[model samples]
Target chain A: MPLPGPLQDLVAEFQRLPGIGHKSAQRLGLHLMAQPVEAIERLASVLVSARRALSRCSVCHDLADGAICRICADPARDGGLLAVVSGTREVLALERTREFKGRYHVLGGLLSPLDGIGPEQLNIRTLLERLRDPALREVLLALEPTVEGEATTLYLSRLLVPMGLTCTRLASGLSAGAELDIVDEVTLARAFEGRRPIA
Target chain B: MLGGNAQGKTNLLEAVATLATAQPPFARKDAEVVRFGAKDAIIRSSLRRGGYPLRADLCFRTQGRRAAQIDGVPCRRMVDWLGKVTVVLFSRADLDLIQGSPQGRRQMLDRIIRQMAPLFHDEEARWSRLLVQRNALIRHILTGAATASQLEAWDEPFAVAAAAVSRRRAALVRSLAPRAERWLEVLSGGCEALGIGYKPGIPGGDESMSIEGPEFVASVLEALGKSRAQDLARGHATVGPHRDDWLARLDGRDAAGFASTGQRRSIVLALKLAERDLLREAVGEPPLLLLDDVLAELDPSRQEALLEAIGDGVQTFVTSTHLSDLHGAWRARADICQVAPGHIARPSVT
Candidate 1:
């Protein structure tokens, strides 16, 4: 009762997913095997096409089938108000909010000193080059509000300030409808320090 | 809250997890749980020995057809099946646990406890409901529809539930302290001392005045009466465990305000490891450990600590772009998966 080599590999592949266990992997493998050959071929084709067709966007390092992603190609976007992000998914995330009308520069990742992701590892050079274009004015950083994010923000501020572009980090404080008293001291302090008077 | 990047990884995890977690920092309600593309999403996980089957079915419509099922059976009540399955999810955003807000730390504590003690979840749910009702009553008082007298009536239930919550949190924090300190020492090489304390609003540590369901209610009522004007103006309950906080100290200094980024991350790792051990102690088995690209964020020493924590084979899931970021020990025990675009493959096995 030996399983086929391809089937065994497929089971092993399914086991690697986030929540799928060995039992679930076996079940998925069986289900895939039970599928019509055409469906299995279609799944394989879709995967291959996606891998072959999609690549990093030339300007922003986001996923794109062309040299430039649609966001970069869109002339309506305000390049001056560029939003610097960490991934292609982030670009789409901001777009879904429908609030940002600016172009983007995806850093691919933040500066994690422990992981050897220094300033050189990110697309900081390209980001600086984008800022130097004169059309870029404000660079909104929408990276996750983590320590690495803070490091990235500090690095960008130093790089962009000399170039005279205004740098901004996404506000990190209490969530909407949350109480001030319940919030931690650091968040409360940040809220106070970062507060602006109502005009 | 489902699609590409906003794929609701954190949100979904939170939604399912809240049932097992007590007095979470998020402090959200069931109504607030549904958003954008979902009408009502039900999370039904079964707790089993070692591993159990889980099914989460959302009852909604595309054109106009509503349906729900779990393991192929029509889902009746989502809560009925909770604690039936053990779930562990990993996401890149979990780096926040190591480098983000105190809310994350508090949540880590609550979630671990919820998985261990189901009664804590019930207590939290009841307390949350009471808090909301009390807040609404305060809003009414602001509008003159309710009086200060109304606050006394609500205080009984609010205080009773809030006391239960405060006691549980304080007890849990006490339990986690030793494990947390040990983990911090291992990760940071004795460079820092990590200590976490529950800062419940009530100061009465006396055994006689300690806490009981009725006494808690009466005490809360008195506090509400005292803060009536303030609560009315704010349109929310002002004095309760709902407004409590967890204080994290690194060498006796507030970790959030004073600790360096590296120090904060070390403390966070200590807290999570403490959670793993605490959950195992409570449940007689370790919960599934999820390391979402966090190995890359840790220093080599911290990475070793992480490897040791996750190496117990209590079932772990880790995601990383670079395979080399994984410690050699973890890689030895791990089954690697490569994810790109729409395809996920096991290239190593192939």
Candidate 2:
């Protein structure tokens, strides 16, 4: 049976979100309706406040509750080194490694021409502005090895290399402890192409 | 290769085709290509490519994509596994090239192109991806979730991919047309004329536009822009190379409209031969031809013509139910293997 007006409206709103189809939206709507009115109000307030409070970092463009993100504000992190990434998620992923002493510069997205994303659409200008800092000695491009990531890396390389910056891309290949046979072909092939001679 | 009806001759061909195309030719289910009792199957073959003997190993699991290796090195993609072991297969169903829908002819041409140039697989895959992404963007626009600017941003890359696919297909058809005509003359003993034309679905209907240059991309971009309203209405791309096709003419006449069965067979055979010659010329080696019980379908004279054309040094495997059906001349020099229920009796090569 068709849902009542307000329930249908809630389901429609849910359906607008990515990956939530009509059935899932309807289920979510019915489930939420069974909750207390205070519970729904609390959920709405939390979502609204979180979205309104979180803004981009002034320095690295990572998600920030204030003008500058925690990483940029941290004095222990190396200021001379910058790891360029495509999104805030990548910043979180790199932070989880616990090995990266440097700060991050998230461009928000890779250069995907097919998706209408180019240099202008990304935070490339801020990236260029950040590169002017003399303390920033080395730059590491921590982007995915996808076609868009490669294109963005190359574009950054052309812009930065002439300025005598030491720009490096992420090392792509089979991970440590991964089985040789189980490694994907693209990764294996990349490992071959990126092979270096050991002294 | 000699085998009776329901024997394992066709299965052998299907395995090789699967290895070359990354898709099984005759089976629907993924596991159907595997042996009836086996959990997995391994096809190991060694052939010389680019003047070096390369060994290819293909492993097909009951589920999941097949893995392929060339010279003990894994292929980066299934396309890399192609062009290593090329094949020219002509079966009874090949007559459908003329009679069937445009998709059949497109697929036949694409198969040959994919085998000859492995990167064609990459371009075709890219085109498919762009098409899907573009359609999704259009759907978003239709639903008011996105704006037209997003679709505009996607149009450039989509147009580039569409242009790339159409250009390669046009070039393939262009090269094959004359060769197919020449082969037709040779197959029909200089009496029949064949004409092959690429029918790309360019917006302005200028197939000649896609044949060359940067202008193809511009035209495709314009076409995509022009069809934006239609695409928005339909929630998909209304213009692209995915709907491309080629036409075959017999004796300077439209083969699809007026050709008889015998004429259709001759044209299809000629196209297959043209494909073989094109591969040979490009690769510097003739592809292995697999004739899977098609000799029995051809009349005696046409069969004689085909056998004569397939003459000499080219590696060929002709399957038949009886030895008498095969030419005596071929039998004198041929190493015939009789395929029975469970085994094939190996013949001693002269």
Q: What TM-score, over all chains together, does every model reach?
A: 0.52, 0.68
Candidate 1 residue spans exceeding 4 A from truth: A1-199, B1-48, B51-79, B87-102, B202-219, B341-343, B347-350
For candidate 2, state the interface root-mean-square deviation in angstroms to 1 decimal.
Answer: 6.1
Q: What is the TM-score of chain B alone in each candidate?
A: 0.76, 0.88
Question: Can you write out model 1's per-residue Cα lDDT over B1-350, one digit (the tens) per residue?
Answer: 11133333344345444434312124454445445476654544453455555554444332333344556687443333344434343344545554465456556656665665556656676677667666765665566655555454456556666787777777788888889899898887777888777765544433234444566556665776777777777877777775556777888877777888778777777877887787777767776666655677887777877777666557665656566776687667777655544344664531
Residues B232-278, candidate 2: write the lDDT tens digits.
Answer: 88878878887788888777788988988888888888888888899
Candidate 1 has a DockQ of 0.01
lDDT tens string, model 2, A115-153?
A: 756567789899898899999889998888654565577
Top candidate (TM-score):
2
How many clashing pairs per prediction, in order? 6, 0
lDDT of 1 by residue, A131-175 (tens): 778777788988885545654675577667787778887887777
> For candidate 1, what's the RMSD?
25.2
Clash total of candidate 1 = 6
